[model samples]
Target: MRFTTQRKRFRDLSEQEIIALAISSEEDDAQIYRGYAESLRADYPASARIFDGMASEEDDHRARLIALHQQRFGSTIPLIRREHVAGYYTRRPVWLVENLGLDRIREEAEAMERDAERFYVAAAARTTDADTRRLLGDLAAAEAGHQESASDLANRHLDADTRSNEDATARRQFILTWVQPGLAGLMDGSVSTLAPIFATAFATQDTWTTFLVGVAASVGAGISMGFTEAASDDGELSGRGSPLKRGLASGIMTTVGGLGHALPYLITDFWTATILAFVIVFFELWAIAWIQNRYMETPFFRAAFQVVLGGALVLAAGILIGSG
Candidate 1:
């Protein structure tokens, strides 16, 4: 409640404060675009150049806004920011934007311009003064033009071949950083846990004991896989991206894979629990095969055959040992 009262309402802000807010917002946006450019510079140089041009355009807008502020209210502009104004659009921090993939960054930039245009249109509507209304209207027009400018810049920098190559690189990076590690973790968790879980189930025929084992195994495997993935490579040399993200993808998927079958064991009836577990195992193996075929480019039939065969052998071994 205290924090809510601290923000100045948009209607309450004077013309000078609005202009000052615009200037600060432009400055912030330029810095964000520059950060995106810098982050993408190494891998996506063409995209980086597009962000550089956008930042330059933002600088021009800032200069124009500052000039207007000086003409109207002397040199000392107020330190008003978007945060100070209620109902103002907020930008994501540079660090957060920097972590996004190339395609996501592009989408974010487009959304930023769209948000700015909408804000200006709303501001123009609220102001009674002709001069302030005209300024807001012009700013809206400028923001609307930014979309065209971005397209022109992209056309100049990113030709068909260049765009295709960059897209391919992005896809490869995604597979390496997320899909590969996650798939491996899923496979490990699903296949490796199968033996112990089934063996314990058949050996004990106790639903509570089986469920406990499954939960313990799933959690332990998840933790171990997470640590292993994080410690395996720094991603600097391999270009696999952040180890933390990779580790999270691996760990969460691993836990999920183990949990898929384990959940069936929660059923009280022994035969019913065992039957559901078997059904879940079948689906899990098929899902893994589908993922391999879809992302890893493995042939569908071949992947299915391999996964199903391996899983069947494991199942048979566990059942036999437990029945003995």
Candidate 2:
């Protein structure tokens, strides 16, 4: 009962706290847009202009908030953030932002404006002071107007060719950041783990032993691949992301890929486990092929042939080696 009361208190924040949170959030978003603009200035000049416009808007909002704060409370405002509120939503990191497609970024921008509008509207409703309420209402209307204004700004800056190029660039970055590492992990897990798992299965002819071997192989491959990927590239030229994040994503996916087949070995019958493992392998290969074609822009037939053929060769090698 005491714990429930404390949780309720943690969940509810005052109007002043909410206002402070909104101010901090807007400032952070403005900085993020500025960073994006700077990063894209050379390759996507048109998109940079859009971010510049957004940054200006954020600056205007911040100025208005500062004025209001000075009039209402004091000279200095306390630093409060989204994390201070128990249930507040958090923004995505800048590295992750680089992977978003143009259309998705536009949609996200629109959503941000809408969220700001809603926050202002709710704040206005909560305020008891007439001046504060009026100011908040005005801000809400401004936020609502931002959605259309952003679209107009984007259209003015970005011609069809520029938009298309930016989209293509964004897609390429997505592949480099996420798909390539993930594919490497999946391939390593699915192929490399096979020999150790199968060797133990044949050697012991015991289901539990086989399962243990499979788990060990899957986990070991995941750690080795993760560290190797992280250490191999510092991402200076690639612009993928932090090596740690990329490594974690790749490593986790790799473990999952191997464990999918390995878990079936717990069935206690060699033939049943073997059949299930084969089925999982087939699905894994198809998934890899699809990802290559869809995200990496590889031709469907070529991607299919390459992935399936390579996977088959790896599978054959693992079997031959294990048998020996």
Candidates' C-alpha lDDT: 0.90, 0.76
Off by over 4 Å in 2: 1-29, 39-43, 61-108, 125-132, 238-241, 297-306, 313-324
1-324: candidate 1 lDDT, tens digit per residue: 364567899888888888898899999989999999999999999999999999999999899989988888999999998888778999988788777688999999999999999999998998899978998899899899888899999999999999999999999999999999999889888888888788888899898898899889898999999999999999999889899989998998888888888888889999998898889888899999999999999999999999988888887887887777
TM-score of each: 0.97, 0.76
Clashes of each: 0, 0
User: In angstroms, what RMSD does candidate 1 have relative to the true structure?
Assistant: 1.3
lDDT of 2 by residue, 1-324 (tens): 353322222225454554566678779879878877786787678988998999888888788777777777765677788666554556677667654555666666676788878877886797787866876797788787777778889889988987888888877776776788988898788777776777666666677888888898888888988888899898988787668767986898789878978898999888898888889988988887788778777898898888778877777776676667
* Global local distance difference test of model 2: 0.76
Q: How close is candidate 2 to the true structure, as a TM-score?
A: 0.76
Could you tell me how far off, in angstroms, the CA of residue 85 lies in candidate 2 after the best superposition? 8.0
